[model samples]
Target: MKSGQLNRRVIVQRATSVSDGAGGQVREWPEIGRPWVKASLWSTGRGAGGGQSAVADVMQDNQAFVIRMRPRDIATGDRIVLDGLNYRVRAVVDPNGRRRELQVSIELEVPENA
Candidate 1:
């Protein structure tokens, strides 16, 4: 894939644990950088949230985006933000088997909407 084909601008974020000083940890997502990626969305549907009785807590499994980039700088826990939507990294694969290009599978989360 050509680098110029990456049209989507996404902010890269890493999940970090901050010391609370109370023997507990506060989780935070800190922005590491921004990278342009080529995104392809698929399989948008509603997903179950919590328990069956908690229908109010139901979530929408909207659009799993496949992003193509160079190398595998992102891990499973890391995520990308684009247009107010959070795309959590599900998996990363090198298509060339030489680490030249990485295809990242992501699950999209739209806050309360999904």
Candidate 2:
């Protein structure tokens, strides 16, 4: 991928678990940094809804994102915010295997309260 196609400014986020002050834990996403990336859909699938929070397990539409090589560590469960939507990272891989770039496999997240 060319550098020009990666025009989308994206904020990388990672989940941090902390006390909710009620003896329970809460997951908070903190912005790691902003990076430019080329986003594209890898595949789309039909989703079935079971309960309020089981939608993602039923089906998922996965996307493949290509971003400029980054120096930080990227992992699963990290998300990229684009156009105000959260694309949850399902997997991260070095596409070229030469460490020139990252290929992030993702799925659209369905809010539990929505």
The number of the candidate with the highest TM-score is 1
TM-score for candidate 1, please give it.
Answer: 0.74
lDDT on C-alpha atoms for all candidate structures: 0.71, 0.65
RMSD of each: 8.6, 7.8
Show the lowest summed lDDT stretch of 10 residues, model 2. 46-55
**Ten-residue region with minimum lDDT total, candidate 1:** 49-58
Off by over 4 Å in 2: 45-59, 62-71
lDDT of 1 by residue, 1-114 (tens): 687888888999999999999999998999988988887654343332211222212224556766777774688769889788888877776755898778777777557653
TM value for model 2: 0.72
Q: Cα lDDT of model 1 overall?
A: 0.71
Clashes of 1: 0
